[model samples]
Target: MSTAETLDDVAAAARACRACTDLPLGPRPVLRVSATARLLIASQAPSTRVHVSGTPWTDASGVRLRTWLGMDEAAFYDGRRVAILPMGLCYPGRLPAGGDAPPRPGCAARWQPRLLPLMPAIRLTLLVGTYAQTHYLGRGAMTERVRDWRRHLPRFFPLPHPSWRTTGWEARNPWFGAEVLPALRAAVAAALAD
Candidate 1:
């Protein structure tokens, strides 16, 4: 496969990107993609663990996320089927109190517009966090956007971050597990069916 074309080119350029030159842990752009991917996991940013491993979603949050989608790791990480892009590719560092800082705004602003169009096969985009939700859906709280996920339909599906913080959120919003996950899983299966 002559991956040296669009997917590979953009991916390589994105990997080598030091756009946010002085990132706390340095510019290790952590994202995954394949030209043939039909499912796009448009997330927030890499965590320290994911950054160290050079793999997106190799953390606690990822585990919960996989469970939410009812997807096994093999299916979830299958590069040929799924593309994982975050609002920021690199780890933006942690806060003084705790938790990861927000992803650099510069990342999506600089790269997404150019990179996303290259993959026309993206049938389903799981916007998995406020950052992704805000960018794609625009001007809405994640709760409302996620609650009204039917409005977006087959193209875009909004989801909350699968971090521990969501434990409380999930407890409060029973519909997420009872309603959203089932629909999300079905959508994923349908998208990958071809």
Candidate 2:
């Protein structure tokens, strides 16, 4: 795809991207973004359900993420208010042992530089998984990054992936609920405030 000057052009180019031919579900490039968006959900990748639905965060993970952000589906999905951009736009397929595979190595490198510049309104980016946290904030334990969320303030907020697997982690880290979530919701609300 050629250089796209506008968000619509970038999004169109992204939707038509076929760079990663090895993707198990093919290159669906699922994402939701707009130039006016202020809150960015920087996640790992689309799940099988999101790939099939062609909508970012359309599964159980999304439910929990929205809950964490104190956002309803309407607000969460509004491209003008929020953007969902993952490390990999397409579903990378499942791991042999159990869970989904990590995102393709080249996807973010190819797209983020192009897409993010178009979103000048973005105030806070929520790094929603290990992939995202590592990509944006550099290598670190997700628990430590999330626990020290206040440090990355006014720009990025690190959080564990909101998958079913995270339930155990959340249970173990009671501070996530008792502390991080309230701050997260407030920051999100402040970012989205008109």
Candidate 3:
């Protein structure tokens, strides 16, 4: 198969995936991947709005994430340049505090290994939220304290979940914006330029 054909096949399978029925709204994994992607953004999962919209990070999280990356909506949604594959594709119901739960384990079990191999040109992967960082980054993950992101800063670009709840956290961790985000922006700009 040609590269385009391969990408098409993968995308079709990604769309057809319904592997996580145990989770809240069933498995409607939101993934956008391409062979030409230079940046891979592996987030936790889509919010209820994102799942309904069939777009990854269509909510406030996406807005904050795009701001952090210094990318406008057009660049952020360009699949060829920005491959977005969340750890869990579906909305995993709501928590007691009324926030949505993490992505289902079944989604990751089904997609990750398959998708990573297809995106050869991915230079920088933005591992958003503790769940993604934990799954991708292993033992060094910041579990209880998402603010202690300093240890894993430069390597994989670890970040807190871009929710309204994290506004104070973002303010408290001045280093995240003042220090880490500049490097992330430069890295993103360089990768996109290349």
Best by TM-score: 2
Candidate 2 TM-score, C-alpha based: 0.97
Single out the weakest 10-residue window by summed lDDT for candidate 1: 1-10
lDDT of 1 at 9: 83
The candidate that wins on lDDT is 2
Candidate 1: clashing residue pairs, number: 0
Scored against the true structure, residue 63 in model 2 reaches a CA lDDT of: 95
In candidate 1, stretches whose alpha carbon ends up further than 4 angstroms from where it belongs are 1-5
Error of 3 at 116 (Å): 0.8
Task: Quantify all predictions' global Cα lDDT against the true fold.
Answer: 0.91, 0.93, 0.77
Give me the runs in candidate 2 sitting further than 4 Å from their true place.
1-4
True lDDT of residue 96, candidate 3:
90
Tens-place lDDT digits, model 3, residues 1-194: 54443666776887887666576677676888989998888888788898799988889888998888888999999987989888887778898988877677667767787778878888878778878887887755453334454454444667777889778887877777887778778878877786
User: Rank by lDDT, descending?
Assistant: 2, 1, 3
Candidate 2 vs candidate 3: the TM-score winner is 2
User: What does the lDDT come to for candidate 2?
Assistant: 0.93
By lDDT, the better pick of 1 and 2 is: 2
lDDT of 2 by residue, 1-194 (tens): 96538888888999999998788878899988988999999999999999999999899999999888888988888888889999999999999998999999989999999999999999999999999998998899999999999999999999999999999999999999999999999999899988
